[model samples]
Target: MRALARLAVTTLLVAAPLTAVTAAASAVADPTPITVLTSDFEDGTVQGWAGRSAETLAPSTTVAHGGTGSLSVSGRTATWQGPSLDVLDTFVKGTAYTISVWVRTASGSDNARLSVERRTGGVAAYDQVAGNTAVTSGGWTNLTGRYTLATDVEFLRIYVETASTTGAFFIDDVTASYVPALPIQTDIPSVKDVVTEFPVGAAITGAETVTEHGQLLAKHFASVTPGNALKWDATEPSENTFTYTQADPLIAWAKAHGTAVRGHTLVWHNQTPAWVFLGADGQPMTATAEDKELLLGRLENHIRNVAGHYGDDIGVWDVVNEVIDESQADGMRRSTWFTVTGLDYIRTAFRVAREVLPAATLCINDYNTNVAAKRDALFALVSQLRTEGVPVDCVGHQMHINVSWPSVADTRAMLQKFVPLGVEQQITEMDVSIYTGSGESFPAPPADRLLQQAYVYRDMFALFREFAGEITSVTLWGLADDNTWLDTFPVTRKDAPLLFDTVLQAKSAYWGVVDPSKIEQTPPGTSGCAVTYRVTGSWTGGFQGEVKVANTGTTAWTGWTLTWAFTGGQTVTQLWNGTVAQSGTAVTVTNTSWNGAVAGGGSATAGFLGSWTGGNPAPTAFTVNGTACTVL
Candidate 1:
């Protein structure tokens, strides 16, 4: 059920948080390659290559990378409009593919790229395979990257285009090859039994209700949340007309396995059809009394039929989703529903759901709730709604965290802040993302980043257990990395955020939650802080450095000052994400406005460009806020 609304918050905060494989391969192994498609354009034929959107595609005899001709793409008006080839028939799901293309711009320098476009359920998602390198008029540059096909595709295509230029470009030597993923082990312990403090769950679509994915879900999870099936658009696309085709299978599967069901989002700003906000004139509705009445009536009707259909089969309901925008002065998202009916829409959604399923838990959910300002705004709204005797029951924190953000202490504060309100809490949609910024796109998950992700899961799960009384349940956004929404959100790249890998095998992240000892990294210090220094890059007399300061104790530092002495005569000329001051070998760095606070199990990073003489060596000792840190 996580659409783009949560991604906006995740990107701003600079953090967040995979497929299944076959049964026969019992152990991890390197992916084996299989050539699937190739096009040198030597035959002087277009070879099913067509321009996407309004562009043109033709063979260019004058410019070729390998033979006498290459495919030319011209008349481009956008970055995505380029030559495309359908690969759905040839591509295999859950298998990785290496894409290679040779590119040359016709006139000037431009960055060429290879990307795959997937059309699933009428939605288009573009995943980058290779190329973002600058290419000029004459020289042909080889662009290469890798991709793993996601399951359940209606259509698929591989394309070549420039990053920003609308000018003409020529491409040659296109290819696609499949790489088999490592096998998943079936004898592993169920994740639900490991986290006995509360129920463990996942959000799923119809695909997760059958085949290997269904078996995996039924084995590891105690509850389920229908990702998009229960939403307004999926259940009731037209007025007074309803369809349960998508949601029925998922609900029935959970019930057959004796698993609990959490009906996701009785109402949301996104994904809801436009007719709900339109007036009798068939135009967009305004804030007039007539429009408000129409909007509320539609909302009531939608909730009554949708929630009434499931009844007690669904134990929990997200009454209103992503309705809090902390950036707003009033802490409210100005959706059309809010624009028309004010707060009555939320009140009506919950009240009607309670009437339809009296024993179900009606919760108000929002993302970025770990942020102090956002959670405070959510707390204020929930407090007011409950005080007014609305049927508000729980607060759902969409814990869409990343590997390097919002420490365990901050998450603890999120639950503690809601404790006084005496309302129940749940980690509604949890995932630990590997990439920290929008500028990054990895062909595959890096080993080091996955280790960091395991640590994030370990620390966060430990915090959730500490407040088990308040947090009644915790559900991951997806069952495995192969089917994550992160692939298309924030940016088009592969992300490993769940307990299982794309091939349906348990990963180090699963071990982090079920048994932390299996993870190989050394444990953090019990008190003070931990500091890691790395010389990221180095040239003749210049170098780039990165410093990560982690708060290892239970108390969070409102402000921190890190001091260290360089052994290799290094001088920091510039730094970002933190302030730096140096006097000879002694250096002191302080946090900036956005990254000053560091909670235990949470870290702050600062990078710098510096000048080094002779050989550059890492600092051996460091201190944060006057206390000595464990140098890592």
Candidate 2:
């Protein structure tokens, strides 16, 4: 278990210190930042700070915020050492001082002593100040101690010594001061700055099969695809002629949205036009050389022309798709391209694409990457391409994930292995589908599936954050269930993995975009606003506000009245530090806690969630204590 602990030292002077040292004779204080030294040192990064028992001299040290670094020593039985202060030079009697540091055992046995001692007169040995054995695993634990300087002590040393051989230690943020108190701060939030321009794009067809659900999704997404855009039959229905009418709408829509389009495929076996399968003399390519050359020529021309049309507007071209299978030699999937143009077809397609769309990113997109064998095959193919100097720029891992498919950890590890290749990795076409009546093999129920979706999205994003420099982007196949291909593919009517549901409502997965715990307010005027109002009125916070009510003298027989409105755009979402009650024509809210609520009396208690959406409205009228009050 990994752990983090912190110790804060604060002080109040009990009395005036008795002066014992002459002016200019005071000792220099400890200068080194708290450092944990140990054997089994790996590398400088925290991930490399690890311990293995056989080797001597290297132990791990964690920097601030749980980041780790390493230290090590050399000998027969290794000794791992870490010090809060490497050397301390002077001491003055009667001055109170506090020292604190955070420590944790990342992995291994926890029997170790964190010691502080004073060295007396050159080499006369040391005396202990304080030590503690109360420590827990897997979380930050604070260790602290205070002491008054003695007249004779000249040096101080702090370290960790252990009898148990195997384990790792990490320390961070060491501080020592004359004052007794420490500052407090929370972990840095992980929200990223949202940017507006769209980058990569792709389209989806079969929306009618999945209506509005798909269209709404497409509107929010970067690109759209008319599935089967370049299938052989559609692009080249005859032996020598090619056409582009079927794929124009997708390109047109993508152009209007400033989206980068992706050409679905250039070479595929399943949809080969019938003419390419036969020779001019009427013989199929399976038995004749003339037919094979014609097929290859057609394939090359198709790639060059289709990819050439859009030029730089298309960001990526799926130069080769699904070209690896377990039951193939040299890691090439069995396809007509391989059977006819042979494995060289891959190199040829890339060469042709380079000649055409010279700036577009070229990728070999594949699925089943989570499976080791398939992934290994992909690695080998990409390695061969790199060795041959093929112009492949990215590896598209088609993440068609489902519940209980590839575990998140395994998927992350699989991606990690590809980092060495030095090409951008992207999770393209991601979806988590749950089909009904598929037994336990299918995903869980909608509620559980939603939660699982949120967890997976969060974990995946966290992994992406860790590898942000290496990964360029993550693109979901569809934005909502309406257009997701999962419904018809594989014959399962599953809910598609996406941020929005069928009715275009944001799902819990949308929370994955930002931490849901941070979303404390709902947009005002939506359904359930009144119920939420009643609940929020009872809450209170450090800030305070006042309430007012007015009858306007038109409606009679009022039991009570209270009304007041807030100044500025102060939105009261969750009411902390206040109390609110509705009486007659107005609502009277009060600050019940020590922290005032949004400024008292003249201010109105606004119940709406406030957002700076480019406009503001100042209060024009107010009713305080049943008396009409105008802004002063």
Candidate 3:
């Protein structure tokens, strides 16, 4: 459902975000030191380790993350061929645990990932938690992750799998034990309801497959941008053949849901049909007036057909996307449109859009405007178009950010810089990345980093709130962790960039934007409502949990809101089918109108995924309708 063909910005403009993390060897946390289930392999032996793939394994003293010995694998080229261990009878089920490995490559860039999984029969077969870290040629990197176990798995595999381009590697200091999850702060408000100056939204594609994703969009977002359907390729797959099949449903749904639609990209360098830029003979457009006129006419016709059809339904249209390429000294990308029609192509595209939807906002969108040089070049182009009397209404900075770099301060400066142009600004495709900018996946961002991401989010929203006069809208690229494109970009890796977790639950970062303070930093406990916390699954750096709510009182609870907090820095990434949020350690879970009525003995349940540091502690307290449950 998502547009898989957007311009790749990291490859063209390699701006390394600030990374203060260390790759030096470090000690791993032993959360359950009293009842350690596994060995760290400090002894020079492979007694507890085995390889599932065809790999030679032996104990090595060459390098280790913590101790003296390490598991060495050689003659392996596949990335998924490193290590495996059975945990069926040795590990406890329904508890959070982690595996930390210090690893380095023998000759490769980096190629080892630790995975723990269980296999059930049929459709439920082969589920696991996987987390990895990048290793330099000569340095050792520590990788860690937390996951939960739901059932008594008879066949479980704890393995370090290498990628396709793997060589020999050494792994050491592996530890897996139950770590108590910290209770999260859960008393904060939702970012969408709190920020009113600009409507909040996310780009969605086929939210049908995941029911929770659609529910989150319906509850939190006021606008919708079909990431790919509205593009020329999806809307007009064949020349002169406009198919609203992919787009019509989204628009109709938006109108019915009281959500506005933002038309994504009437004109763009990518996703445009080849025929639009091809001549009658099916070749490149010539510099002749015919080719120029042909391309210009096609551009105008496309704008009229699309913008004119939707008209006011599309509150704003990305008239042009990614025209400024920073690879060139002047920061202008060379494309067929620019070649055939010169710079007038952009101006003409905007003119036609303005003519069709005069009242709708027309925006020129691009990625990587957070970088100063590219930002300046973008301003230069927009300034030129404005000086020429083009009908450009707003500027879109695709704020795909990282936790360490492009600090919110820098982003605000860029937004403020465009205010003088008299055009409004919108963070068009905003998703903050968690990768540490080395083009390689670092271990899952630790809790502190996630909190730091929350602070950055607050600063960003604060900037937006401060500049409410100039900022019109702020759209998160995607709503949930699993719906984003950050995982498939310049370097393929798992990244938590959005406010909601992969499980569709809110993160601490969500609180940073809503109201940072006032969220109590304490673990959850039973206050006024009977709340039951269950460990469904946990592995690597994350875990899945379920909460059951029961009235367990004489009165029937209606319109109930359950609240709890975590002691550790554990965060909820995704919450299944229910509305949930976090402040610090407090977790507030509210039911839909359908499920709000819990009778004197009835219950409701909601599930979520969480990330933890030293421990994963279940909430001890919960309150429903301002009454503390008696169970805690």
Per-model tally of clashing residue pairs: 16, 54, 63
10 residues in a row with least lDDT, candidate 2: 1-10
lDDT (Cα, tens digit) per residue for candidate 1, span 1-632 = 44642211001011111111111111123233445777778888888999889898888897997669899888999988999999888876645455667789989898877777777689665665553667899788866654655356788988887788899999997766544444345788898888999999998765465556678888899999888778887788889898786688778889899999998888899988888778999999999999998888888888889898989899999999999988999999899989888899999988888888899999999899999989999999999999999989999999988999988888888999999989899999999998999996543454557789998999999999999999999999988875677765776566879988766777789999999989764445545677766553444566656677777677888988999998889899988789999999999999999988866556777888789788677777788888888765
Better of 2 and 3 by lDDT: 3
Q: Which stretches of candidate 1 lie above 4 Å from their native place?
A: 1-28, 49-58, 62-68, 72-174, 205-215, 233-249, 252-257, 435-449, 487-494, 522-632
Over all chains combined, what TM-score does candidate 1 have? 0.66
Question: Which portions of model 2 show Cα errors greater than 4 Å?
Answer: 1-202, 206-219, 223-226, 287-289, 435-445, 516-632
By lDDT, the best candidate is 1
Per-candidate Cα lDDT values, in order, are 0.77, 0.48, 0.67
Error of 1 at 206 (Å): 5.0
Better of 1 and 3 by TM-score: 1
Model 3: number of backbone collisions: 63
Ranking by TM-score: 1, 3, 2
Task: Indicate the worst ten consecutive residues by lDDT in candidate 3.
Answer: 9-18
Q: Give the Å error, residue 312, model 1.
A: 4.1
